[model samples]
Target chain A: MVKKLPALVGLAVLLVLPQVLGAEYSWLVLLLNRALIFAIMAIGLNLLTGFAGQISIGHAAFMAVGAFTSYGLGKFVGIPFWGALPIAGLAAGLVGYALGFPALRLSGHYLAIATLGFGVAVPQVLNLWESLTGGWTGVKPAAPYLLGISFREDRPFYYLILIALFIMAGLAVNLIKSRTGRAFIALRDSEVAAQAMGISLTKYKTQAFALSAFYAGIGGSLYAHMINYISPHDFGSGISMELFTIICLGGLASVNGSIVGAIFMSFLPKLTERISLVIQKSGAFEHSHFLQNVFKNFNQVLTGIILILVVLYLPMGLVDLWRKTKNLFTAKGVK
Target chain B: MAILELKGVTVRFGGLVAVNALDLSVEQGSIHGLIGPNGAGKSTVFNVLSRYYDPAEGTATFEGKDLLGAQPHDVINRGIARTFQNVELFKGLSVMDNLMVGQHHNFRYGLLPALLSRILPSVKREEAEKRAKALEVLEFLGIAAYKDAFPAFLPYGIQKRVEFARALVSQPKLILLDEPAAGMNEQETHDLAQLIRIMRDKYKTTVLLVEHDMSLVMSICEHITVMEFGRKIADGTPAEVQNNPAVIKAYLGEEEEAANA
Candidate 1:
């Protein structure tokens, strides 16, 4: 009961967020929705890279596959968003399972390079396959409606994304705590020992890829419907890099860390914009065009520095920092 | 009847022969020991049984099943489990989770069941049963206190015991323990010898271990196989192997050299 308090309070806050900030700060809700979507992807990627010890810098390729699949199913097959979402996930999972074949034979930077190829290849393929993907023009999915309730509104859409994130997160948590999750960690730590214990390397490695992509696909479906627009530009290799950064920043192998990292990443651009606005208002760089140009790209520089610092000082990530702080406070009270 | 039999098993790496036409047979429901000096290919033999190493020539069978034809992971499913000489406990998992992984074959459910485990009664029941079994093994091995602790945090001796607990949780018909007493002190080794016997009795399992600890081996093993330079030097009961001329020469060098000195 005591352990449930924090989660209950968090749920309450998520439920009241849109109502509190819907009319005045509607954009914040939208940004939070995007963060929730990325959180879903981050959780999935963490299972593959963090728990299973498989690297994938091409995760955005799975998202691209999901987005287009969902779009196509809605446009041609006449399936609604809810009906098409699982199918999109399955389609992406199939691609991930195919990618797992290369992963079986590769590891470390070689695997990264293989996945990077997939990431770079996907958008180009989407662009060239004009008949299905609509090429450069992209696709617009219909607003998702369930029963009589329309989720086209930003507030309702935020709730919808939040609900999806909740379910996905629950499922991921269950997986990590089960026998399958133990096999993944076992293989990561010691392949010889894992095999000795009856865990099939081929089975679990591919399963991790397929499951991770399933989450990414669902997140992509949500992303497609939320924005109502997607193209090759939306799921570029850059997005893949961003998703990788989110897992590292959050803390590898931790579900909470993924969510924390996603929230931080989603708001980072806004954070930089606010800082630049304040500096400009203060007239600090009025005569220096060089500094102004630097400020315009400040977020990129900040991201690089933060990543380097996190790698060096807090290798376990922001979740580790939170744990350390909590420990400090508890220790002081006990003393 | 022999629970495990290895006939004409030869393993070579380039010009080097690790196990040279080795023949070994362990009686059913007995504690067997394989001992030799460093690089005597004792571990290589264990690896062969574990299916980690494919022999150049031989037939290795467990209860009449072709062990060599099976995959490494399938060895566990075929009622065999092993511990590593280096103690290959999963560093990322807790002690309990480590034991749970040992029962991987017992879980038998697919990804869908695992995902829906939170809602499904069957999955939940299986998980609980596995957990209870793991805890029982931990208690039996006297490491129940460390069940929640990660492998990295435990002492070397405790980690080794955790490995034993892991192998035992599977309730396998045969267990291959590679240097199970390597890192233990004298007292822990004594306790381990007693534990091994009790475990075999309690679980009705057969154990074939490779060890350098002679006192522990001679005291507990019902039968012994001695190897040198990848060839069997002697095979008998403890007293018989202890007095065998070849076994003595292999351990303490030639009688002529000692007489001259």
Candidate 2:
């Protein structure tokens, strides 16, 4: 029971966040909701890249596929939003399974290039396929309502995403503890050893891809409903890079790291924008337009520096940092 | 009766024959050793038997079933497990988890079943049982104290023993030990020979070992096969092989010269 204290505290904070913050700024809830949804996707991607030792730069394509599939199923096909999400996940999982084929034959940079091709190709295909994807304009999904409760409000939707995040995160944790999860780690550590131990490489590699895609798909489905708007632009390579950055920041192979990464990604941009505004108003760069221009893009530069520093120093990520911190505090007899 | 038989197994690497036509048999319930010079292809024979390499020409039968029909991954399920020349324990996983991985074939549960194990009683029971069996093997191998430790933190000898415990957990009908006493001191090597004997006598498991340590091989192995340049130079009881002129000229003579020096 004591082991669950931190989780309970975290849950309490999540439950009270909107109530406490909604009175002052309502938009923060929406941002937090988006972050939670991305957390699910990050958890899934970490399983593929961190645990399974598969490199993919095209994860955003899976999200795009999920968004589009859920949009079509929920809007055109008349399936309810609740049902459409899973169907979208299924669609993305199938494609991911197909992508796993190339993974079997190629690895490292070769596999990354192959997946990058998929990422680059997806938005183009979506833009050209106007009949289904609405071309460049994209589509707006209808607001979801379940069991007489309208999720149109930000708070309700925030709760929905929180619930989804917890469930998906729990499932990922459970998976990492099971036999199949062991197979993934074994394969990652040593392929020859894994195969000699009765783990089928073809089966588990593809399954990891499919499972990760399934998570990304659910995330995309939730994203489509949350913002009520999505286009190819929303899930381009930039989003993929952002997801990768989140995993790196949160720590690889850590489910908790995925959540922390999503939170960092969600808030860091806003924090930078505020800093940029302060710098612009300070008039410190008034003497030179070049310095002013540099100040304007300072946030990007800072984020890049932070990423570099983290890679150099905290290679294991924020999760490792958190563990060390907890260890230090607990050693002080906090319990 | 022979538990494993390799007939006319030929493996070629481009222009070079890594393992020439080799015929060998490991009788059930015995400790057998394969000893050879550095390039004698002792490891290649293991690769062929484990289905890691498809022989250019040969047939391997385990328990009278065609081994070539099985894939590399399927070999473990067919009652065979092997340790690598270079230790291949998962670096990040604990010792206990490594041993548990050996019992992977014991649990027939798939992904869906594993996920639903929380709700399914039988699957949950299977998981607990596998864990119990893994712990039992750890105890049997006397590595229970290191169960929670990672492989990188353990001593080299302990790491090797953990690998043995891992193979033993699966309860394979035949276990292959590749260079088991490669990096051990005299005392550790003697202990390993004793453990190998114990595994055969107490556990009733067949061991097919490849060792460069002649003392351990002569002391423990009931039968020994000597190979030179990928072909069988001598195969017989340890006494006969020790006396064979071909074996002496190919392998033992160099050892004897080094000893004298």
Candidate 3:
């Protein structure tokens, strides 16, 4: 019960926040929604990278597949937002499943390079195909609607992202506890042992890719609908790197860690911007715009510093830190 | 009757020839031992049986079925499970979870059922039952206290026993235990020998173990196969192999060669 109290409180806050806060905290609401969407993507990547021990730097490419699929299905095929979501996931999943073949042949840094090539290729493909994707300018998908509620604004749409997060989070939790989930961890620990235990490496690896893509696809669909625009510029290697970093920054092999990581990533820029505003007004670097630019890019620098610190001091990430703290307290009390 | 048979099995890594034209049989409900000196290809035989290394030539049959064609993953489904020379327990997972992985073949529920386990009572029941079965295996191995603890935290002897429980949880017809007593103390090795006998007596499961521990091998195993430089030097009962001049020369020759060099 103690373990579940925070999530229950969080759910209540999510349900009540938009109604109580009004327009003053509209940005907060939007940020939360975006964070939830990214959280969904991070959860998927955690399974592949943390549990399955496969490095994929092209995660955002799967999201791109999803976003464009939603656009194509919604705009060209006239599919409703509800209908387009699963279809978009399917499209991305199929592509991810195909990528698993190359993943099996390559590993470690070679796998990272292969996935980087894929990450770079997706946006190029989006830009090159002038007819389907609208080339450089990209496609502008309309705001999604369903059941008499227009999700043109951030408040109502927050519920959709929330619901998706809940379902996907539940699915991830369920998966990690099941036989297949055990197989994934086994694969990460020792492939030879896992194979000896009757886990098909090829089958599980592809399944991990497909499932990760499905989550990414759902997140992309939500993103496309929320942003009301689709452009190749919206996705790049940077976004994929962010997704990978979020999981690592939060915790590996942890569901709650992904959520925490997504929230941190989503709010980081705003936090930095606020700091920059304070720094600019304080007259610390009053003479030059170059110094102001430094403040503007402070988030990137801080992110790099944090990544280094996390790698050096907290290799298992924040989740392990939490466990250590809890263990310390419990041990003292018991003693 | 033999549960496993290897007829003229040969495995070569480049030109090294790890195992050469080996013929071996493991009888059902018997503790069989494969013993040899270093680089004698004892572990290589286990690898070939587990299908980790495909043999250059030969046929391996398990319970009258052609085992050579079976995929590595399918070895457990065909009622064969193996432990590694260096314990391959999932260090991240708890000891119980590692055993649960052994019961992979028993999980009949597909993706939907697993995902919706809370909503569906039957799936919940199956999951509970699986957990119970895993706990039972842990209790059987006398490692129930460490079930919730990660394998890395456990002592080396306990970790090896957990690996044994893991393979046993699958209820395999034949288990290939590779160097189970490698890092164990004398007491632990004696305990493992007794456990192997109990496993054979109570469960009637066949065991094919590869080890360099002569006392444990001679005490527990009804039959033994000795290898030297990728070839069978001797195959007989413990006393017979002890008396065999070829087996003595096989061990003495290696030490003498090392001394002379």
Candidate 4:
């Protein structure tokens, strides 16, 4: 119970955040909702690449499938957003399962390349199927409704996203602690040893892909509903790269790392904007258009530098850094 | 009765024949040893039994069931477990979790059940039982204290013991131990010999081990097979194998004609 206090408090803070922000800071609420969606995707991707040790560079394709499937179901079939969410997730899961067949034979950089190909190809496919997807023009999904309430406003929708994130993250934690999760880690450590212990690679690999994709799909559905509009470009290779970056920067194989990483990623651009504003106000580089351009793209440069530093020094990720610091303080106290 | 049989088993890696027309049998409830110089195909034979390598021409069976037809992962389910030539404990997992993975076959729950384990009573019960079983094995091996520690941080001897504990947790009928005493000190080797016997007596497990440590092998193995260049040169009791001229020649190299003079 003592160990769970921080998590409980964090959840409490999340619950009351929108109310605290009030109506004037509604934009921040929208940003937080986006962070929640990314958190959901990060959790799923972490399960695959972190615990299962299967690399997927095409995760956004799963998200795209979920987004488009939900949109199509809602607009043409007249299905409600809530009903389309699960179906969209399943559609993405099927695609992930199909992708797992190639994954079974590939590993390391080879798998990364295969997934990269997938990430690049999905948006093209979306663009080609113009009649169904509206091509490059994209589609605006209707606001979600349930019972008597319309989740059209950012505030109410934030709660919906939070609830979804809670359920998915909880399930991810459950899976990670179970036998299936052990099998994944087993195979990751040594295929020969894992197989000798009766862990079927074909079974677990495909299962990981399918499950990871399912989570990505749910996240995508939430993203589409929250943003109100999405095009193929929204789920492009860049988004896939960003999702990959989130896991690496946050920590691999850690659920908390995924959430923390997603939140950090969501707030990074805003943080950079604040930094640029401070610089401009100082009048140090007001006349330098070159410096202004550099600050404009500062988030990407910072993300790249942090990713390299993390990989070189903190391979276990930001979560491991937290653990190390706590251990350090405790050790000093004992001394 | 022969618990495992390899009839005319042969494994070839391109031009080199690893195990050539090797016929060997291990009896039920016996401590069997396979020993030879490096590259004599002792590990190859173990690999064949584990289904890591397919024999170009051979029929391998476990308790009269076709072993060769089974997949690598299926071998454990068919009551055969093995340790690697090098300790292959899952480094990222805790010692207890490594042993839990060894009991993968015992957990019958699927993905959905595992996901809902918190709410499902049956899943929770199964998890508890498996954890208890893992703890029991760890205690039996005297490594229960390190259950929560990762294998990478443990000493070499302890890591090997953890590997043994992992294989034993599955409760396999036949446990193939490849070079179990490879890097052990004299005292650890002695303890390992005792442990092998204990495993057989306590669990009714048949043991097949490959080792370069002659004293430990001669003391523990009830039956021995000596191979040279993938051919079985000698097979008998430890004393008989020690006396065989061919086995002596294989180990000592041809008695030099000049030395004989």
Candidate 5:
């Protein structure tokens, strides 16, 4: 009941959003749609870091694979956007599975560096292979198909994206409660220890990658649909770092933490721009060097500050805060 | 017939010799203990037997099957399981989840059924039965009470017991326990000794022990092997090994105590 009450309240908010804030905040809803796709990326990254203990700084590369694969399928094969989505995810998953081979031999920081290499290399492939990906211009959406129902408006696309996010979240919840999920956690906890317990390293490590890539690919696919166009610029190292920030601030190993992390990190830039505008109105400070710098690079500075503060103050992430608060109330006046 | 055999097992790391042509055997349904001084290769031998370390020169035959060049998982799948001296428990996993991972070898579902269970709500899966069996093993181990508790949060004794359960979950033909009684006080050691015997009598698991705990080793082991400088110095029934001169010198160090003492 305790858990359900909060979920019900959240559901109520989702149910009321289209009515209360839908008309005025259509752009806000669109931004949230972007956050949902990245939320999937954050959740996928969690499988690697939280469950497998494999630090991958190249997650955006996998997302890029998803995005580009979707585009490739549409352009060459004339597959509809929805038709290419799962196929694109599967292609990215195969790439993730192949990445797992190196993981069997290397570990810790070395694994991170190797994956970072993979991340750095993926965008270059997309750019150099301009025959398919159209060089820097990238590709735009060619409408969407769903069981013969065509989507031609922002409202249908928004609701469609919201459903995808919910489904992916549900999938994550299911996986975290299963055997492979536990194995991933066990592997992350200690590889030698996990092996002694009969958890095979190659199997679980590959599984983590395949799963993480799957979500990222699907997230990327859905994200391409919503954004209407994508290029190498969107799914670059910076975006990958943002995904990392989401997982780290949410908590490395918790399912719930991924969503919370996504919510906060996603809104941060918009919030910073709002602050920058406020600072702009106060013309008295425009000539000062510090104010000028803040105006120019306020988003990056705010993002860096938020990340450092979250790491310092809540290393366990927002999940721990929720747990602490719940404990406070549950144990109130008891002892 | 001897169920497990090690013929001329030698492990070399560049110039240094970790194990020098060690040879021994543990018969079916017998408790065998391998003991030595701190630097001796008793644990090294165990690692070689479990295929964690490739021997520089040796062939290990278990139940007439070749063990050389076998991967670690292959060794376990071939009915050999082992616990580490340092208690290698999956620290992030709960006591129950750890045991489930141990049962991974026998669970036959491939990636298709595995993913199917995740995607569709209405799909009936063979995955449930595998999870059910894992729970049964935990229930059998009496630490089922710690089912939801992570190994990191458990006490040393409980963690030790969890490792034991993990090793035994596969129902291996031979179980190699490295210092199973290490870091335990009297009561826990006593319980471990009793539990070791119970495991053999109940599960019919052939036992190979590597330990520094003399009292527990002497009590639970039927046959014992002593090693020093990577070679077997002595081997016999515990009664016979107790009086061996080489065993005394290697363990007691120029002292006069019997090997079995």
Candidate 6:
């Protein structure tokens, strides 16, 4: 399952064609674009939590920091998107590294609580800081780096996000398959064993935290460019919850799982609306109040249930499940 | 020359002294044994050497260097590696991957080299070399078929073998094996003895083994240091230790002592 066999090869073609085809179709394409960009965010979080074995509940705070940094840089310094892009990422990464010093002492639920507090505190502070952050007023991001190419519409924004996501994803994939990734996994599994094996726990733990933050920053930079504007609300508690939801649903220790999760969360509301419309026409679902309530409030409950189930039963995540099923069929005597 | 020396070492947790004023030394290029009854501080001394526990009062010197102030990793970097009494294997990782991780401290690739390898095709020759060396170690340990297998899936004996393989990958000057043969059967214990000798002969590894099994210790250890209540009772050749009255009283009862005499 993880062998990367051109799975969903035609997905981009099927998605991008609709945007150029018509007006209403273009709106769906825009949503798909946002989903892809968010997938980068999910991928970064996965690298931190899954591969690196660091628990970061306030990952969205780091994202907000990236977005704000990009906006502040683009507007005040007259820096274009290209200049602020990496700068924003670096800024977030530095903060992440600093945070790692404290966060490393804690693990699992305690670490989560610490980052969760950071997540709550960061946005509120941004909102209160009127002079730098424009308080609750929000900031408008400057245009793309090139003077000739202004990203006015969703399609242009789509291409920029796609490129950014691609770069970040490439970096993440290469990194997690390397020595650092092995160290992270080892530290995650057992600190005593890792130390026994001669791994410097303090050094590697901090590295994982910093690298994960860098990825999150890149995701935020891409997000800022796509949206063209940002407010404290854009990166508040709701954003943190959503990022947490994506990581949990996808699997804690997976890369492609994040992409799968992002796509699912992005398309869910739209799919639910469509399903409701079809069911309303059928008359049975529409006339029954109980069934109608189930369809209406079902998603939030379903997401909650899925998170709980994945934690308890499918802790290895979807990727391992897919691998096992594939192995079942491919086993020597099975054929 | 003494490779590792402990002087006036004492470890106290509140009212209990796990090890008290213990003076000991391990010679260079030799298999040294530390044996004690349960809770006699055999493991406590190992912990102090690995920098896991700060001594209440002691001077630990490794190859003329003070070992007291060094971090656990700095100790490893300074050519001291150790295993745990309860096998601390990275259970989620494959056996080969675990050994490869062990060699992380000795990785030859620079930052630019690491980046360059990723960009280049054909498996980044150096990484492949490291992987090949890891396989070589696996083959040497006779668990190469289990290379891809997770440590959790392996039998206890094979896992112990893999842990030793990982420690050797670093090519450390001294290896502190904390009860390497603790959970092994007689056959596995015999194999472990052979592997220890092989490691000493092939890698020129100086080994300090903490074991409860007197038979394994007597069979493999050229020199033995006996501990009782965290203090060294005797230190000499295995025969010399066997003959010592203090060693006999600490390890065996009066009835067995009388029979042996």
Winner of 1 and 4 under DockQ: 4
Query: RMSD in angstroms, all models?
Result: 2.1, 2.3, 2.6, 1.8, 3.0, 2.9
Model 2, position A268, has a per-residue lDDT of: 81
Give candidate 5 regions above 4 Å deviation. A4-8, A145-152, A279-300, A333-335, B116-141, B255-261
lDDT of 5 at B157: 92
User: In candidate 2, what are the lDDT values of residues B168-213, reduced to their tens digit?
Assistant: 8888899999999989999999999999898777778999999899
Proportion of native contacts kept per candidate: 0.88, 0.62, 0.74, 0.88, 0.35, 0.44
With candidate 5 superimposed using the best TM-score fit, by how many Å does residue B6's alpha carbon deviate from the native? 0.8
Give TM-scores of chain A for all candidates: 0.94, 0.94, 0.92, 0.94, 0.91, 0.88
Q: By the DockQ metric, which is better: model 4 or model 5? A: 4
Between prediction 3 and prediction 4, the one with superior lDDT is 4
Q: Give the poorly placed runs of model 2, Cα more than 4 Å off.
A: A1-5, A287-290, A330-335, B252-261
In model 4, how large is the Cα lDDT of residue A218?
93
Which residue pairs collide, candidate 4? none
lDDT scores of the candidates, listed in order: 0.90, 0.88, 0.87, 0.90, 0.79, 0.79
- What lDDT tens digits, residue by residue, belong to model 3 across residues B119-211? 677877888898899898788778899889999888889889999999999999998999988988898899999998987776668999999
Q: Candidate 6: what's its TM-score on chain B?
A: 0.91
Cα error of candidate 4 at position B181, Å = 0.4
Candidate 5 lDDT, B38-144, residue by residue in tens: 87888888878766789988888989989876776677788888888888787777776677778767765544444445665432343566556667766766787
Q: Tell me the docking grade of candidate 1.
A: high
Q: Which ranking of candidates, highest lDDT first?
A: 4, 1, 2, 3, 5, 6
i-RMSD of model 3 (Å, 1 decimal) = 1.1
What are the per-residue Cα lDDT tens digits for candidate 2 across A1-335? 75566567767898889989845689999999989988999999999988898988889999988988988997678998899989999899999999998789988999889888898998898888877688879888777899899888899999999988888888888778788888889889989988888989999999999999999999988998888888887888888888888998888998988988898889887887788789989999999999999989988877777678877887898767766777898999985
Query: Which candidate, 1 or 4, would have the higher TM-score against the true structure?
Result: 4
| lDDT string, candidate 1, A215-256, tens digits | 899888889998988887789888999999999988999888
- Top candidate on TM-score is 4
